[model samples]
Target: MSDRDPSVSDEEWAAFVEAARKDGVGSGSVPEPRRRGFRRRPVRHEPEGWRTGPAWREMNGRGRARRQVKGVVGITLAAGLLLLALRPDLITDRLPEGFGGPGETAPLAAETARPTAPPSSEVFPDHPTLKEPFKGSPALGWANGAAGIEVPRAKAVGGMSSEEVAHALDSVKRFLVAANLDKATLRGERPTGAIKLLDPLQKDVRAYIHRSLDEPDENNDPLGLFSRFDPAEVRLAGDVVKARGRMTFEAGERSGEVQVHVDYTFVYPLVKTRPGFDEVARTVVRRQMAFALYDPAKIMTTRGLLYVLRMDESAGNSDCARDGDGFLHPQFSEDLINAAPLPGGPEIDPYDRSKDLADLPKACGTVTRT
Candidate 1:
């Protein structure tokens, strides 16, 4: 059985031959089909059979090449698409530095960021300076005064600045001291600044703190931070902050329309000098956390008051370390090994006033900075 149409007549053959002669044999012309080295391979013929013709031979070669070409094109296109899917950054990063500058760039997917706080020296210069917690109204109500008992400062969705968020986190610097040294906070007495940071979520969250401090677990007291003695002997410095770039807060599981998300990492040292001991005990606490709060009235400056709907705790280490130059070095906690959803990272921020980070982790265990 022949695969050719098999019904071709003498008339069709005559027309094909006429067209080939007219278009071929070089009357100063190259047929489109012959451009790619496509030509008929001569074949033995059987009388009156369609398979024994030049036209058939030419048609077979042309069709085979066309199919192979189509397959190659399809395969190449598919491979290119796969590569692109795996690495969209290859295309995105090549865009101009200002590709989406100023108020035009799209925000990142989540607020998953570490803090970018300025160094400790810059934020709070004098250490061990005691501050009394607000004696009356603030711990109870708006204490913000003219702003009224209702703070209307909650920012719009994604409106809080890194500075603002860092400020909120920094506001707790003294709190750490107070919590560790001052009895006021432990008993639920929050300072004016600390009150603001704890706003919207104030009471319940304060209770949470009290409970944590009261926990009887030894591990919970890590190096006596929660159970230690001596407020007069404690001294510390920190550079807590949020990650640079587009840091944004969105509505959390509890409804963002009525709340704002707050997340950051805090890095600081816990320095304590004992009355009888000559050497001071030193430890660094690197705490990373994600929290959501409710303050739709914008009470906490528009982002609403922080009401800690969700929280995560990272590592903190008391291991004393010395730099290459022999100066003591601080670090995030070792608790990450136990259970820190987000592992701790070194402290970093643009506002560092230190001449150098001692080249930092490199500076650790290395020669002291010259």
Candidate 2:
């Protein structure tokens, strides 16, 4: 009819037409109106604060990773420092040359004195096999047999000719080898070779040796003069014997007499006599003796033969309670375990050759090591 419904007011009709146009209801091509539920909701924007957003989370993650890395580095550093503190030798070994200090060289472990406290159970650590008899002993590095007994270059001293001094030193070395290193002598046999090297006129010395061998007691121990072991009880671990020491000559208390001082330490490796037993024990014997070489013209004494003026000896790892059976009885691990408590005495380092054997306390003492 009149281009609008008669019941509709003009304002209402105008609003309806504007709404239809906005909705594209009367366009050349009509489009369907969108449904209420079909419209997309506007995106909800998060807060702009850096500490509460994704960017903040990324930075925080990186910081946490860095802290973890730092923690690991700190732990490693602490462990390394603790290791260095506990074993300084490791550091010294790795350091470059000249790092120790100017004109300073690190001392070898073998050279340094390792004076340990008296053992509680055994005289020496147990070596269960004969493969390495000298294991855990300073003698491991010592020269074998007569090679260790190096004679000094002979020189005239106290009015003796160089040739005479040389001959005297040779004689002393031969006697030492015979008394200490000879296989037969070590097996409880009489040290005939050693005896022959001595002056025949010294009947007292010969008689004493013979008596000690024949009737050995606590006072007249043959071990004081010879390194003998009972063949029935123990045998030499190997053919090698470790030795180290020096010999020096000076003027004797009388004219035409050259006194040769011999300070030597001999290490003997022994094992049980039983065929199945393989336990190795070491006996350390240090002998300090003075031999007088008298001139035939001036002193009217035997030529080339050495006269025994003094003899002192100290032994390590031997049974302190043993009453001299003419052989050394080295204490083994089992012996220590089953035996009575060892007698108390001063602790001595058997490897310490710096002091004279005579200076050691003349008592049954515990040795620091074998």
Best by TM-score: 2
How many pairs of residues in model 1 come into backbone collision?
28
lDDT of 1 by residue, 295-353 (tens): 34332222534443332222222222211111112222222134322213233221222
lDDT of every model, 2 decimals = 0.25, 0.59
In candidate 2, how many Å is residue 64 off?
A: 92
Instruction: Give the runs in model 2 whose Cα sits over 4 Å from its true position.
Output: 1-128
Go through the candidates in order and give the clash count of each: 28, 0
Q: For residues 2-101, what per-residue lDDT tens digits would candidate 2 score against the true structure? A: 2222345557645654564466542443322111000011112211221110112113321111000000000000000111112243233333222331
Question: Considering summed lDDT, which 10 consecutive residues are worst modelled in model 2?
Answer: 68-77
- Candidate 2 global lDDT: 0.59
